[model samples]
Target: MTEANGTTELPKTCKAGVVVNEGPDFTVAVEDVPVPTPGPNDLLIKLNATGICYSDIHYMLNDLPMGSMSSYGVRSPGHEGAGVVVALGSNVTTWKVGDRAGIKPVYDCCFACELCWSGRESYCDAAPQIGLNFPGSYQQYVLSPARYTQRIPDGVDDFVAGPIMCSGSTIYCSLKEAGLRAGSWAVFPGAGGGVGHMGVQIAKAMGMRVVGIDGGEEKRELCMKLGCEAFVDFTKVEDVAAEVVRICDGKGAHGVFVTASSAPAYASAPGMLRISGKIMCIGIPPIGTAFAGADPLLLIGKNLTFSGTKVGSLLDTARALEFAARGQLKPIYEVFPVAKLPEAVAKLRSGKVAGRLVVDFNA
Candidate 1:
């Protein structure tokens, strides 16, 4: 295949990080697996790096109540992928064999759906997640739909390209949904987390005065280094909500971006909203739970808007990549070998990781 393609030879078996004893006892182990063949309109990507997201932990542990990876016949879990295309299907034309591409949260959507037509394909009801519904980027080789796979720009390296596949781009969409103008105070509840940190940088880039909410000195330093105008350490504050209210001229901030999954973060979010302010819900709670700011009366009284957004569309992802290429949005991640995926996932599950964790398939 290398002689035919003038590049990497196709290997019958490739190394992959496979999940074992999924659900609370989940573990990832590197093993040799059969390389997949690309279907029509698909591209076989030899992934150089993949980003580890907390959602991968939920899928591995069955933390979300709805569905399990086993139920979908999925063993490897990952969505953030950055690599080069080694093979293409018969019908592919838009991409070359060696083009750089990245995987995203949503793998493919039904193009015929109303949501897909309306430019909201991320929320398409029939959308299949890359890692959850299919074999994801945990392996050295993975397949992505040719049209859906994002093209990585020339200037962005794999380390930065991988996280933008999901976190950076998703938060970019959320900051746009926030609709806050320049100089408005916008607070990120989990500013030290991957998505929250992305929000902080993009929000600041958008000319908004940013405040970051997190737990300790490490996170505070990280937030401050990311250009957050103010940092609120929730552990030391008597009342984080009151502190935010105090910081924003006693009327609360103009916007609050909730990127933490903690119940307390959701509970105290409304208290940080000013009159007519917005709270962009970017986190997911455990199954069967509701956000604490779901009170109709509070929204009515404050005339506030509460909205939820999922990941970004393909166009949004491309634009977000431009942001990274231009150095406007930067990613902070700790890279590890694919063999250390279980450890990375454990660290992320422990909630102690300050930023994103990425795995190099060849490291």
Candidate 2:
């Protein structure tokens, strides 16, 4: 129960989607877990929605060479979480109970690190990941460090804000690193998936012309609706690279943003770019199974640049939220009840999801 003054009657136990097995063959089960208390500099947040990301699948499969979530004794796997703060830590005076908050991929990083000071805190070695090294938002009641929490604006819905915490901000960071200005040609491979769709919107909002590459009519419609100037259906096109080059005025895209983990996406990216074009790598393919590179001659001749980025810093997330609040970025997502989290995870694993899939705890 919540009082008018924002005081909450804390619950002893809350519903959570706990991982049944922590390996390749794993499942999510709904269970009652003990509610976590806020630390001296933390806040107790009651999550309304959490977006499912492919990174969660990697953590559960124990792949990616990043170690297993079990190493940290974490069961629930989720990072994009939007909710309301129900309690504040004793030492936290910046946030109040009932304030809207969201948790990002990086739970906390050492503030004194060089990377943290240089606007690259997401790569800080001392950072603990939200779902990997800490109990994540799959638990209804979770604790968040007040310093790293994102303040959700009043107009943005939870479903839209949740995915922005990760997918939206991640692609936004990659786009910023690409350094493409307005009217530049931005190509998005796998442009209809969770992260890719958000990239389409953000790039379009930034005044860049977007070309989306994916298979099927559904994704084509989505990309077109989201402001893609051109779309290539790989399933129907005999040569995806040729199609992308043709669409980009016969020169090729200014930047290729690879948001799909498929190896083919990486292999075909360089060919779809013009001279001096850049490749912004966002998706993680299976460890050691894939790589993105071009021959020395091609790299030197074309002067192409390859850059990779992890999640975004707090500033990047704030800017992403501003886009959402200003009606420029709207994330497309499907909602699932907490009990059907397993079904949602399976759908995402199938690689057919058009946009993001979010699980609602209060549903």
Candidate 3:
């Protein structure tokens, strides 16, 4: 691990990753590739930590938007990234070498577009995802557009801030869009999984009462530890949705944030929403999958608003990290070495992982 002439050379080809095919047969391999070079406005980050996200598994399973999947073809998978800036392109100014920066889901965005101007670059019509379209952080080092990488605060550990870049930020944005007030009740469908766990803690930190819905004793214990006001084990409950409604005093939740990709969980959303309530869709419902829940007329009658939210902007990402820095929110994580990605992904696919999974570069 030596640096010379601004080249971080370990071997001629350092460890890197790629997606090799289609469907479950599609595999993520950790062969080596030439180290990437920084372009103008790009900063080369020597990644210390990266998170395995559900979206990565979705892409490997061929579960992305059909148009984008076909148009972009397959690429290496990764996005929740945290690292130290090792080198910067000549044109980069906002950051300097040694700055702790995060390469988020958003790699390059049309910064001049209306969405970006409004601080929603994650939703930029011309946005290109990191691990999705471009080569992402599943490598020795990653090159990121300086404009899109947010700097992590000095007090925050990179491992803790890694999930905040993507999964944590997505839930944060969804909660913001839901517009729940202090003391309002919000139900998170998959409240014990990686994203749902973070959302439960964040919702509690915002002073909202959180109802967690997930199964098993481990998840139930974790949800309770994360400050959830109620935990409904879907496996044990007679009616999961009704349990959520009961928790909200029969008025239903002020809002229900669907963090689980299960169709049945999504189908239960309308029943859990109070009158004039909102439903925020944060999880990507299963690929090639569709839902026909709650009628259109019922939406009008309940005055409910259904919305889709992407990850937050760079500013929002900074705020999310701040929550972690101040100890107001915590990202529970299971650490694994970079070489063990498949095992980590398998745990996630099996729905057994309780919190986020982080790949350790220095392990």
Which candidate leads in TM-score?
2
Q: Where does candidate 1 stray beyond 4 Å?
A: 1-8
Whole-model alpha-carbon lDDT for candidate 2 = 0.91
**Per-model TM-score versus the true fold:** 0.96, 0.97, 0.94
The lDDT leader among the candidates is 2
Query: What local distance difference test score does each model get?
Result: 0.88, 0.91, 0.82
Pairs in steric clash, model 3 = none
Q: Per-residue alpha-carbon lDDT of model 2 for 14-68, expressed as tens digits?
A: 9888887878788888899998878789998999999999999888888877778
- Assess the local accuracy of residue 294 in candidate 3 as a C-alpha lDDT between 0 and 100: 78
Which regions of candidate 3 are displaced past 4 Å? 1-11, 66-74
Question: Which ten contiguous residues of candidate 3 have the minimum total lDDT?
Answer: 1-10
Report the lDDT tens digits of candidate 1 across residue range 1-363. Answer: 121286657889988877899887888888889998889888999999999888888788887865888989888889999999999888888988889999998999998988998778999988899889899888889999998889999999999999999898888888887788999999999999989998899888889999999999999999999999899999999899999998888889999999998888988999898999998888777765656565789889999888888889998888889988999888899999877877888788899989799998887
Q: Tens digit of lDDT per residue, candidate 3, span 1-363? A: 223345645345556667777467776677777767778888878889888888877877776663333346535678888888877788887887788889888887888988888988887878888876777777768788888787889888888888899988888888888889999998998999889999999999999999999989999999999999999999999888788888898889998988888888888888888899988888886665757357988898889888888889888888888889889878999998878876787787788889888989888
Candidate 2 C-alpha error for residue 273, in Å: 0.8
Best-to-worst lDDT order:
2, 1, 3
